[model samples]
Target: MNDLDKVESILFSQEKRFRLVDIPGAGRGLISTSLIQPGDIILRDKPVILGPGVAEDGTYCSGCGDISGSNLNLMENCSCGLRFCSVSCKQSWHTEEECRIVSSIPEPKPNQNYWLITLRGLVSEDPRIGFLQELTVQEGAGRSKEEDEVVKLLSSFGFKEKSILTVYRQLTANTFRRGRGRGLCAGVAMVNHSCSPNSRVWWDESGSLVLSARVKITPGDEITLTYCSPLLGQPSRRNKLLQSKGFICRCPRCQDGTELGTYMSSIRCTKCKPGLICPVGLDEDKLGWICSSCGFKPNPEKVSGLLKKVEDELYGLEKEKDPGRKLLLIQQYIEKNKKLFSSDHFLQLRAGDLMVGLMNKLAPSTSCIQTKEYYTRQTLKVLETLDPGLSRFKGFQLFKLYQILFEKIVHSAQGSLKAEEQFQLVQDMQTSLLESKFLLSGDRFAPPEIVENANLLVRALNQEQVEQIQDKINQKYKIVKSVYQCI
Candidate 1:
């Protein structure tokens, strides 16, 4: 067999069950031999590459991936002596009975670590929660909760006290240190990384983590998803992965920024004449050129330093009760960074969203006013650039448009003509939402609060009107499915 075939054989023998093949210029990579549809179980191998430390502290859930506090709290250990987030999960575990065998394993010696046991054994348990068994085996004899740091961190993130303790006890019972799980499915682990990935990773109702291509992925494309938050740019991502994963990623996306010399080492010139030239500071390497017209070149360090300051100010603005103040801050950030960032930059897009949200909050009744009309147009422009019809932003902008039109119909002092115009606007907004496949797309990029907010908005809309909208949405979904089948 050839080298590629040899690699595939080794991986399959290791129980990864994925086949490696060449993708022309992309080199050798794993691909699904079976017809893997959206949200299908592509692979379920152990982690080929595990991080140095367990994600003891994070903004998200390690269990269910929920950012909301309403998620279940930790419960007592099940019959198998395994702890879960709640009684529901514990009961579910009971049916599997995988934990019984796992929990019964003898603990390791004082010097032995729990993660090591997992690495050593061939655990044939549920991949979703099977990692817990490794801990169970390692915790063999000794059982002591010596002030759990991970639990404390989770508690600080507003996780329920019981939930925090439960997860901690469970993790504590196993391994406290990090270790890699060999023989993990290459289709899952070998998937590449991207700052703007076309796919999203999600856990279905069955608790199995599934990957869905958010955008159209070519047949031979190396399927990838953003491991880190996309809201963060290059340097932040590198720092995080380095600190947590202990690997300096040489991924194309990461390398691209470094090669461009845009890894927090350059900024646009604010003083440059509108069309003449844009200047950037020259450091160890000449990052960019200086503008001749205004002789403008910003210090890269100074520009990078303002990022945190801008973020802090934005946070404060979000918390402010006065909508005008919030809007001002949003505009201030946008105008100040206009030269520093491109119009299509994610930060600018986010600021545009903030502006629309603040407008809605400030004057829901007058959002369609000529003064606010410009903002909506700007929002539409940004959302279109980001993903056009296949983005959560598109749904949000549509919702905003619906709100503006609805408010005008309800509160306007004008005659029935204005009401008619508003009605047409609402219809247009609904059509836009349906065309975008907003509901079927699933909420990945949007914050949990935003999803909740959208749900509430849907609930508040006129029942008959909503039913009509749902019908249209369903029709559009059918068409989209048909198109995908044809493709």
Candidate 2:
């Protein structure tokens, strides 16, 4: 059988809701075999090989999996010269082939830090494991000098020439960071990257990788994953992918800098109201950025200087302890760099998010509350364009809006409101609470604290509902939230 047949057989060997399918130029990608609704768990697979992250932190016990400190320092090296947390850990990691491999290698040297995971992979290798041959590694992503050193080291052990490179190729294209090091999840590795994806992957309690549908996916639709964060606008994301992965994304989001009318990375044009400053499309353009409305192009130095000022101020604000001071600093940042940032750009969205958090902690004033509502609404509007439906980001945004709307209601009653305005505020709170609950009720990506807010919103809604079922609704929330360990 050919390569496709081998991959097909591997994919079908287990119970699966998806299949490997060919994409022109992009090689192969996973396509849903059945219609998948939003929040459906599509696949769960444990990593075939688990090892240390690329940048390994303080040492971990190979045998017991205990991290560095205390008794770990007291423990002696194994016969193979590998440190272990205890005798059992040493015994556990010292399998026959691993011991042979370890015993043959020279001592660790400075600047060979890159070989840590490679060493673990060699240690974990079983003769039964298969090298996935179909995935190609580009030249710059080709074998490293350290890798050649590893190959030379392993060659003395009678391993075949090019054996290490064959395995390394399978690893480079497939692995993702579990913590600091690469996790080779075979099922997850098959799903190719897209900036706007229908599905997402997360780790469940057991550490098995779980892929869930973020949007309703029709049968035969490709199951794509964002290899990098979609929270960033197109240019930052593209540059990151190119720097790390050696691929220029042609995903529709990358092709269009306007980013579905969100203007996610666009600077606001000083010349026009609600106008975007974007990269003028040319491979060798002198005036890098142009206003979308007036064609007012700013020189590269002007844009770069403004961005650096904002960056320095944002960094300084991170160290500010006083909420009032931070808020002042953030506003100053906005006033200082208004020309370089649009409200929709990732940097401003991030600032808005930080400001909202600060507002929550501050004494609730009319100005603070109003600012919270504005920023929360701005965040949700950006979410609609970027993440769209049933996402953790959207869920969190709705929760914030729900809180802000309820705050407005409390403040309205405290200061005395007209009956009509009071009635409308109550109606708006109920609507916001229900929207937040609907979006967040099934979100597995939400942390325990954020997930509990969904219950609190529902409980608040119960008070507004008829008194007859209020007890019943409260009891029901208690039961459901217990499953999430939040009650």
lDDT of 2: 0.64
Which parts of model 1 have CA positions greater than 4 angstroms off?
A: 1-86, 91-187, 228-268, 275-298, 315-345, 367-380, 383-389, 392-424, 436-487
State the lDDT at 222 in candidate 1: 59
Q: Model 1: per-residue lDDT, tens digit, 294-322?
A: 66655545555675566566667677777
| Residue-wise C-alpha lDDT for candidate 2, range 98-153, written one tens digit per residue | 66666667666332234444555555654213534334445556556756876776
TM-score of each: 0.53, 0.69
Find the 10 residues in a row with the least total lDDT in model 2: 478-487
CA lDDT of 53 in candidate 1? 27
Could you say which candidate leads in lDDT? Answer: 2
